[model samples]
Target: MSELFDRHQAVLPKWLAIYYSDPLEITHGEGRYVWGADGRRYLDFFGGILTTMTAHALPEVTKAIAEQAGKILHTSTVYLSRPMVELAEQVAELSGIPDARVFFTPSGTEANDAALLLATAYRGSNQILAMRNSYHGRSFSAVGITGNKGWAPTSLSPLKTLYVHGGMRSRGPFAHLPDDEFIAACVADLEDVLGQTRPGVAALIAEPVQGIGGFTSPPDGLYAAFREVLDRHGILWIADEVQTGWGRTGDHFWGWQAHAENGPPDLMTFAKGIGNGMSIGGVVARAEIMNCLDSNSISTFGGSPVTMAAGLANVAYLLENDLQGNARQVGGRLIERLRSGCAGLPGVREVRGRGLMIGIELVKPGTDEADPEGAAAVLEAAREGGLLIGKGGGHNTSALRVTPPLSLTQEEADEGAEILLRALGGG
Candidate 1:
């Protein structure tokens, strides 16, 4: 093992996952590429778990961070903060919730935890509805509602979490049905689960696109239909947009918008991509729901000026450049190209996802079983071919995740696609 890898293994938790059998240490990055400690440049397709929303080392974000750091680093929520208030205002205006309020956190786990707190408090119930095969976060509160067995470490939790269906559209009992019928079946399943549960279920939290579950998503309008049932029960809808937010999904600004017939979610949690690399996460909710917490609460490092400045610049650049349009146009072509390339590869089961977030599922040559070893092989081969990617799924970890920065260009997309195709053992 490399010296750094040995040190990391010695210090970090053994369960903390790292990619590849031989982990490569990235030294620096620029644009859509990164350089490893060995001084080799590689195209970055995963964008550091999609946190680098814009290109790597974006000048605007770096400048903002530097400027903010030159000034005061933090003032805490105990005092008034201009950057915090400004970013919160921007988030509230964009959140689509009526009379919205915002609270920032340092990571998505904490953001989801805070959302759970708000929902349970607002509705006076500790029961939460979460989708099966979903990966929320690692915090105790977040993990309590996580349905992915691999990600959920312990059964012990503060809340009683009930697993629901409809997150994973493929490989389910209803997968053979048409989109409309599939949605109906999932809705029926939801109703059935609700019927068995006691009254006052606090809320139903979901990721419109299951991020860690290989970018899986339900049929369009499924959540809208579920909204009707949830409304009757007085349960809030919390959209976990940690991966699918901020136009990463191309067709919609937020993933929940894909299912928007009844309107915006009651509460939304976002983390990844907002700060372009800086640590920033938060929850946006209607004012009434937000104010439900009677006691005082604050996140000490949540809205620090440095991170807020980075977020402000990152969001502004994302909007001004119309990166969402770029994602739509470039990502459309990239997925099509990948689909064509994988058509004849027996080991390649599927090429799926929208916008800059894509996934490639591997399987045993002629079997339907998940081929995690194949996924690992492709990760190693992609690295050897000068491409950086990621992988995730349920406990099997059988799908390769391709979430490049929204600012990815046509040239970069083609280059990364070719590398990935070759790595997949396809021409």
Candidate 2:
């Protein structure tokens, strides 16, 4: 092991996972590529778990951060923050919630936690409904609602979290059904779960695309169907758009738009991409629900000037360049290229996703069993071939996640696809 790896192992928590047998030390990055400590450059397909929204070292974002740092770095929420308010205004307008109120947090976990606090306090209930195979964040409250056991380390929670069905469309009992039937079955499952729960459930939290659960998602209108039931029960719907926000999904600006039959969600939480690589997460809610919390709350570093400046510039860059459109055009071609290449690969179980958020599931050649080892091997091999990717799944982390930056170009997509195919033994 390298000296840095040895030091990391000694200092970091044992449960913190690192990629590859010989872990890479990324020294710097530019555009869609990153340079390792040893001066080797690789195409960054995963984009730092989809956090690098625009690109590596984006000029606009870097300038914004630097400018803000030159003036001020840290000012607690007690003071007036122009950048924070400006970014919040942009987010509130973009968020479809009417009369939306935005509260910034440091990360997606804190955003979800704040949402939970608002829901429970507003409805006066500790009961929450979370979809199976869903992952929200790593906080105590967030993990409590996490249905994937691999990430949920503790069962203890302040709220009564019920695991709802319909997050995963495949490998479940309902996977055999057609899309329409699958929707009906999942709605029925939701109804049954709601029937068993007590009165006054606070909210139902869900990711439009289950990010850490290997980018798996229900049908387009699944959440819309659930919204009808939630409305009847007066349970709020909180869309966790941490990974699927900012047009990453291509088809819709927000993943919730795929299921927009009823309207926007009651509450929404976002993080990851808004500030590019900066730490910025937040919850947006309608005025009434947001004002429900009687006690005053504040996030010390949630809306730091530098991060908010970064967010403003990053969002502006994303909108001005229409990165969402780029994601649609390039990602559509990339998925088709991947599908065509994997058609004859027996170990490939399924190729699924929307826009740039794609998943390639691996299984034993002739069986339906997950092949996590195969996924890991492909990851290492891809790195060896001058490409970087990531893996995740509810089933033993057997799915390869292919979420490149929204600014990924056609040439980069094709090149990365070729490298990935070779890693999968299909090139």
Candidate 3:
């Protein structure tokens, strides 16, 4: 083991998971590549779970940060911040919620926490509905709504959460059903669960693509159908877009747009990519719900000028360059390439996800049992081949996660896929 690894184990909590058995220390990054401390260059497919939305070392974001730092690094939320208001206006416009208001946080966990607070307070209930196999965040409130057992370290929660089905399509009771039938089954199940809950269930929170649950997602319009039921009960719908937002999905700017027929969600939380590796996360809600809180609250570092500056520049670059369009064109090709390449591999179970956020599920050769060992081996082999990937699942860690920066190119995609294919024993 390396000295740093030994020291990490000695000082850090054992539960703070590290990626590889021999963990990596990435010191610097440029474009789609990041360098380990020992000077090994690796193609970064996961991009810190898709936090680096645009290319690394993009001059626009770096310059913005530098300029803002030169002026003032931080000013707490008590005073009006120009960059923060500008960013809020842009996000509020993109949010699609009528009369939208935005609240910033330093990370997605706090963003989701704030969303929960607004929702529960507005409806006067601590009851929340979540999806099975979903992973929200690590906070006490966020984990309470998270359905993945491996990520939830605590059973004690402030809110009463109900776990509903339909996040995973590979092995659920509805898995064998056709698309329409599957949607019906999940809706039926959701209705059944809501039937048992008390009158004041606040909201049904979901990740359009379940990030740490291995990028599992339901068919399009599934949430729209659920929205109908939620509307009947006056329960709000909160979309957690931490790993799925900001055009990563290619076809849409927000994952909930996949279910546009029912209109925008009552609340939405986003992070990871908005600030292009800067610490930025936020919640957007209609004015009515956002103003429900009676007490005054502030986020000291949430919308600080520096982070907001990064957000503004990053967003401008994304829009000006049409990186979402790039994700659509290149991501489509990459997924098809992976699906076609891994089709005959006995250890491969399914290739799933939309646009830049993709997952390859590993299974036993002829059975549906999760092959976490196989996934781990593939990850290691990919690293040896000068590529970096990630592993995640509901509890088994049986899936390979591919969430590259939105600026990924056709060449990078092809290169990463070739390395991944070799690692998976396909080449």
Candidate 4:
């Protein structure tokens, strides 16, 4: 074994290694490529789980951070900061919710926690409705509401929550129902839960495009229907855009906007791409929601000047360079290529998702069910072939998630697709 590996095995906590067991050691990254300790460069298709929107070590973002670092770094929320205000205003404008109030946090989990707190205060309800296969965050309350079983171990007793079915097609418990029937069943489930549970139902949280859950996109008209149900139940709608936000979807500046024709969410949480890997996350709520949390809510490092500067620069870069447009164009091309390239490949289940957030599901030759080993093999093969991708789904089953940076070039997308195709063939 290498000396570094021996040292890591000796000194690093066993629990930490168990969480991230990958053996590869990456030393540096630039653009869509990361260099390993062995000096091999690999094309990164995951884009840091969709966080590196502007690409690795983007010059403008780095410059902004450096400039801000030299000037001043931290400023408590008790006092106003220029960068914070600027970034808040820019985010509000970009979201098309001009009067939206922004609350920054250091992580997406914090942002979701904040949003949940605000929602509870606003509606005076303890009940929250979330979709199955959804992942909000790992925090206590967020995890409680998250529908994934993996998070169940974290919570002592999952809070008062109701699970609604979402995605392209509703099945399992939702098998007998048609599309409209499934939606109605979901709404009825929420209403029934609200009626049976405690009086106040705080919020109905959902991802416009479910991230960790195989990149599942909600069925058409589902958002609007869910919004109507929430309104009828006097609950707020929280859009968990932590993974889908910041122009990753290409059609809109915010993920919720893609479903605006349905109904805009009352509270939207953003992270991942907002700071372009600078550890910034936030919640944007309607002014009414902000009003409810005035006295009780607070954060020590929520909106630091340096974090705001990085976020501001990232947003500015996205706008100035029209990276969202690039995401749309390139994402379309990539999706088309994948669909065409693997049209006849056995065990290729489906290609789903929007813009740059794509998922290629792999299954047995004759069925649409998952094949986890096949998926792992594909990922490993792709990595060996100098490309890095990510796996998703509840069991980490065969779903290759392609969330490359918005700046990914057409050639790069084509190469990634080719590599993925070759990996699938090996499987």
Tell me each candidate's TM-score.
0.99, 0.99, 0.99, 0.92
Q: Tell me the deviation in Å of residue 222 in model 3.
A: 0.5
Please identify model 4 stretches exceeding 4 Å from their true place.
1-22, 155-158, 168-185, 294-297
Q: Can you list the residue pairs that collide in candidate 3?
A: none
Per-residue lDDT over 199-309 for candidate 4, one digit per residue giving the tens place of the 0 to 100 score: 667888988888887787755667787777677767788888888887788777666775576557888888989898898899888897877765655567888888889
lDDT of each: 0.93, 0.94, 0.93, 0.80
Across residues 299-347, which tens digit of lDDT does each residue of candidate 3 receive? 9999989999999999999999999899998999999999999999999
Which residue pairs does candidate 4 place in steric collision? Answer: 125-200
Q: Show the lowest summed lDDT stretch of 10 residues, model 3.
A: 164-173
lDDT of 4 at 301: 88
Q: Can you rank all candidates by lDDT, best first?
A: 2, 3, 1, 4
Q: What is the C-alpha RMSD of each candidate to the true structure, in Å?
A: 0.7, 0.7, 0.8, 2.5
The parts of candidate 3 lying over 4 Å away from their true place are none
lDDT of 2 by residue, 74-130 (tens): 997999999999999999999989999999998999999999999999999999999
- What is the Cα root-mean-square deviation between model 4 and the actual structure? 2.5
Best by lDDT: 2
